[model samples]
Target: MNPDQFQKNSMYIETPEDGGKNFDDDGRAKRTGTWVTASAHIITAVIGSGVLSLAWAIAQMGWVAGPAVLFAFSFITYFTSTLLADCYRSPDPVHGKRNYTYSDVVRSVLGGRRFQLCGLAQYINLVGVTIGYTITASISMVAVKRSNCFHKHGHHDKCYTSNNPFMILFACIQIVLSQIPNFHKLSWLSIVAAIMSFAYSSIGLGLSIAKVAGGSGEHVRTTLTGVEVGVDVTGSEKVWRTFQAIGDIAFAYAFSNVLIEIQDTLKSGPPENKVMKRASLIGILTTTLFYVLCGLLGYAAFGNDAPGNFLTGFGFYEPFWLIDFANVCIAVHLVGAYQVFCQPIFGFVENWSKERWSNSQFVSGEHAVNLPLCGTYHVNFFRVVWRTTYVIITALIAMMFPFFNDFLGLIGSLSFWPLTVYFPIEMYIKQSKMQRFSFTWTWLKILSWACLIVSIISAAGSIQGLALDLKRYQPFKPQQ
Candidate 1:
């Protein structure tokens, strides 16, 4: 079924017209401009705050290697998107729902719960990744402000003036603003976010290119030799290989769940009405080029010791106006992207409530042990409590794991294997009703095996990275 029809059919009793299709709402299905759906996904996924560190990661692969990885990622991303579109075109007929849930998709493939196990694995993986992203973004913002904007040196007079306050404040703001749940309301924000993201990316690229053209070799040496640089991988070929692994990383960037949510955004029109293919292609190509530029520019600018937080490290000389512009862009960008990740969790909770409980029981609090409330029936009370608690939990998780860029890459490495690599092929086999594996299927099996192996290696590397970060950890410390 098309997106507009899905929205109309899939809504709940309370918010029937809202069409909680995992993504945004579609108020102007046939009448709205083409930019509505096309720009939303790009703004939400491609313009994430993670791009701030693209340069540093790319630099580890060297000047030439970094952009090459971006290109590879773009190609892989394009191919994967097509695969997803294909899957959508020929959905399993048995599953009446137009969209595929992780568990449902698995059930379609592996007969019973084997695929469900995979979906369960994905649940934990996505939760961790989402939490990690929130935390990492918080931390990066902190580092960016702390790098210079705060007190120049130790001063007794500086009270609530640290980066921590700003982080908390901004995160809280995001949580509150993100709570507003209407896609039609958010589309304008997405458009604005896209504009800001493109602008930030453009300026970031220009700066990188300008630095490259300045012809200062010694500065490169400084970047290479800097002891505290986050991207230091000068002599380590293994690290370079890790950098070369951006192809798979780029595929991870596709972030399928986000698309699943916004499925309703894709409206149908008359046969004469052209598909929004142009808008979609534009968004993809723009995002791909931006990644390429950022990767290349970052490596050239920072070399070995480049900061993991690219927005802060090389942004020392960013024009004031541009900085202000990027801040607004990033703020909206965060809102757009944050909703994509959060919507599934919300849907999960919402669906569970609907299936497992009657409206009267929920209103009357049939199970009060886990529930809390302030009024008669108190269902809404506990629902508020539930959402509030999640917000707090997500915030705390963010606080605990603040290494934004590194943690994101680690999550991508560890989880990408199972979720994107293994699950899709498995589902295609069982759900698509192909009795035997074809040549393409054989290649997919090989790819899955490779991904499985890489998942292992990357997990080890990630753990090591974590261990290094926690070197000072101890159950107890001797009294000073």
Candidate 2:
């Protein structure tokens, strides 16, 4: 089913008389997305603020394990994503009924209590991601101000800025863009965001390369096994950081939760699963190359003292204008990503509300609003109010606890095993009717169990990190 079909139910707008030419078999507008657009959405969702933390993750895991883990997670995510892509259609891979959302896929394939669990995990992760994006965007906004301040005043001078105002600004931008109906209309935004992501990531990578080449990194400390147990951290700290680092990488590779939704946007001429598989390969390979470059180069430049965020972490103080531009790119990229992640939640809620209150005009109505130069926009009062309120609440929560790295680790670890690994694996097994003790099934189960362990330890480390940060943190206070 087309997810947007739910939104179109209450609209008073006239339908096109182009017969069935302009609509899909599901009776919604025909999808125009190809592998390229799908790749753009994947890249936008995948290479987010999580990329900035790769240096820190590498530092914690060392040269050997760092790149190895990065590659490992990339392979795992890509492999499972392909599996999930096949689950986009039910009973048959290509010529079957459509499943609109990730939850819908689970309901169609894995039914019963697992579906409920999958929905809970998926939506909770989505909400957490939006909150995390709010915090990251504000941090980048603050970084731009700090970059300018350092350029004018000096590096040693205090350049502290309050994140609350910037977060409010971000929330305002999101509140406006969140009205763009559904995922079907976000292709342009995703493309722009994909460009911005590459912009900042390239800047970070270039800066790291320059630092390594300029001999400023001669005194930088690095090790094969990551942070020193005695000098850099205690043994327990090392253990916790390694787990946290794993979680960070997991977060970096996390786009599987939305893979089905993205595939749902594709035109079905050559088959969506085939196109999505190609898109996933392209997107994941492209991102994996960048991840290796940025993570390794950043670590090579700053070594063990690498900051959690590459662009905003004050690693390079002299290139102030470049830093400002990169931060601006981050802020802009996140503006689009915020919608990509949150739109699913918005769709789910609005769709559910329409069903429950089918007769209420307030819930089921879409009024035609004529705009200047932009043409007519169908406005749903419920959507505007709900989406705006949702953004405000996320912004407030971001203001309350704005720890970036730890929060990301927590979110990634919490969502990775279930959404990225277990659900896809289970759905594939069931849909393919694989024998329980078959080699492929057994190995898949082993992989799932292994990732579950990773998730547990990663979550523990993130919670510990958050706990440590909270002990020294004051709520609503400006961070430096």
Candidate 3:
């Protein structure tokens, strides 16, 4: 019947009073996460490879508009994230039932009819995210390898350019990392991933500032060609550019797909609203600062000449070590980010399997594996096979669809509105039992409706842009 109220055993009924702890003493959570750990995962979820595109985004929007959009979205993201966090609560922890997955939250609030819609959106988001990450890792490895070759050869000689091999190699790394068992177990890896994100991002930002100061930027760049500061563009071009910039920031800031599950990893706490609100503030504020630096400096460094990805704009042996380090960090961060986003995907898949095969490796506390005294969660068969294969499939897509921007455009276009804008607003209103057509409800509805319409328009443009680019670039052809 009600999945949130699904009884794991006869004695365990989750309610608002019990704080969602089904067992009296969960050794798993005891050893798991603090608010710091939760913040680390949120950082991993919030700041990914997308920040690398901010300069290119700012280039499209101009200094004023770009940073304004980023700041606005950051505030909106924090607000919506808190709304999602509120949904994680119940009347009592054990008696009322808390939502662990976005789908579960939707199913509980809206009904089973709307649950699958949430599932479709989430599944697409994760699969697209995994593909996007694989592509990024492959490209980052290629960049790292090229920098190494430049250092060795003392010139800009072309090195190994095919990304498929690197994609496969990176898939091996994901294979190992994705098996960390469950969400809370990933807290450590998420911390490392967040560190690596700052590592590469800071390097990129520092490099951009240096280039801009050094006056190394060419007058004419690929994305910024024929464009100047202060929005001196035509009507159609402005609309197109604004939508493009919106897609970039929206996609870059997107963490809604993983927000609920990330909260699930929090140490059973004094209501997740406070903890998650704190974590969201930390993660989004830090990420916004980084985005502003990267976007603004990147535009300054190579005004009208900035590349779509900031790290790739450096040519030849110039600043070889720093560029190489940035690429390495990109690869490292992607490995962890992949698993962070994929956890809910894995959970969604395995839940069905666990239900179907109750006699198999479906683990409970009593039947848990004897892995360690410290941990309550078990290592099981389904975890090993399914997760490994999922990474492998994503790797294949990376190889096949090698265009980085196109896949990202598609992801941003498709999932941004549903995941980021619409669902949270609707869910909050319904869950809070707010009055219809009241001032707050009316304003939120308008905002969400505006978001949906813009998202649809942007998605259409992105699809067309991606299709035309694929037709023109045909990246799948073996690289020279």
Candidate 4:
């Protein structure tokens, strides 16, 4: 198509007056992102605290089911994510009106109550993830301290530490980092977080490899079908744990909730969907490789007795400095991962408030503030208060519960089907004008329904695990 015709069809015109320098075709600031930045964001969001739990997750299902589930989730997530990337534009993948957020995409394609449902599910999942990150980061912080304590004292010494203080410290740090304007400004942070993820993941993988090669001088039994039903767990306990293990793998592969938002940051030319698809491929393959190695190797090292979080679960007490460094990497990675997830919530609320009360200065106004060494910054009062409050509330919730594995499983189960599978399938069908009950449509529906079943069972298991934990533990108390 010619430039004029393309502009008319897509509603993207670059006028001679401004020379297309400052603003994009959508009247927003020019998006400078390439697939590299998008991949970094994906990596930062995908490889998080969930990776630490994979060894335990694998142990729950044994050898055969664990690796199969990991590959299955990786395939499902990548396929659906590409579907979501296509939805970044509307009727046409390259030229239709832009849907800046996940809700926006839903509203454009599916519309009606589905949009509201999508928003509810997406935002709730996002909030839960931030809370989970808070809990995980605090655990890492506590692990660092306890690791050092174990080194100073004897390995047998009981080095108890409170997670509440570390939770507060993490919240304070988030309050400051939360001020970052939007997703577009987070590329640098995502790069750093992605590196941290690799660092800690590699360390964990290496430690596991060392343990396997060097031998722990103890028999570590592993089975093709996983933990023994009679010896390691009861029949009922095995059922629940298998479900929760699936949920943990689901959590490990989840980035679909923010996939569209990440796509929005990409510059046009090769087309956003095309760029996002490539990024998704790179990001998912990279994470899946790490997930497979970590989960398998850690399982190999610890067998059926694997701890929930190998790094922080006292799986490796010696080489104290290396363990401490890995935990620190985890904490730092979570710091950036928290922002990557929560920034969407921040943007949604701020945009809604501004539109609802357009004339209110407290809601919509921006003020200029000069800072030393950082130059001038634009401050919005409403954003400051709301974002800070959100961080504080999540931290408080983290302190109250702080069941890391259970929380991860629950959040994953709640979000995986709706945000990751169902919506994308529905949107793709609508956008492509697929015939009802067609062969392809039938298979897609089958996939969607299968995932929904997985979500339901996974959720039940997580809730059951949480209930058991709650019965035995007190709220606001240090876990270890």
Worst 10 residues of 4 by lDDT: 1-10
Give one digit per residue, the lDDT tens place, for model 3 in 1-480. Answer: 124323343235344355635432332223245678778777766777888777877877776777888898888788888877877755333334666667767777776656777778878887898898888888888887777777788665646467888888988988877776655565777678888988888888888878877775456342433255354556665566567667777788777877887787776556567788898888888778878888888888866555667787773457788798888888988887787678767775766666767677343212355556666645676777888999889888777677665567668767877887778887888878899999999999998888777677767656655665566664433221
Question: What digit string (tens of lDDT, one per residue) describes model 4 on residues 377-425?
Answer: 9999999999999999999998877888889999999999998999999
Each model's lDDT comes to: 0.52, 0.86, 0.73, 0.86
| Residue-level lDDT tens digits of model 1 in 1-480 | 122223455543454365654332322323233445655565546655557667666655555655665665555444444344334323543223344333433453354566556656666655665576565445434434433443343333222223344446655765565444344456676566667666666666776677778865556643332222344333543453363244224433645444333332455442101233344456668777667667657667766655665655543343534544454455556655555566556555655565566564442253333325523331244455555567667766655445554466666666666665566666555555665668777876787797677566655555555555556433121100
Q: Which stretches of candidate 3 lie over 4 Å from their true place?
A: 1-41, 91-97, 154-160, 175-187, 217-242, 261-275, 357-389, 474-480
Q: Give the TM-score of candidate 1.
A: 0.72
User: In model 1, which regions exceed 4 Å deviation?
Assistant: 1-44, 89-111, 114-122, 147-163, 178-185, 215-218, 222-252, 260-285, 318-321, 354-379, 430-437, 472-480
> How high is the lDDT of residue 395 in model 2?
95
1-480 in candidate 2: lDDT tens per residue? 223454365333346699878888777788999999999778767887898999999999899999999999999999999999989999888998888778779988988899889878978888999999998998888888877877888879776678888999999998988888866565787788879988999899999998889976459899998889898999999999899898889888876867887998999899999999999999999889989999999998888988878776652287788888898998999998888778878888887898889999998998999999989999999998999999999999888778888888999999999999999999999999999899999999999999999999999999998888778886544443
TM-score of each: 0.72, 0.88, 0.80, 0.88
* Backbone Cα, N, C clashes tallied per candidate: 7, 0, 19, 1
Question: What TM-score quantifies how close candidate 4 is to the native fold?
Answer: 0.88
Which residue pairs clash in candidate 1? 22-261, 23-261, 23-262, 25-183, 135-398, 136-404, 229-305
lDDT of 3 at 456: 74
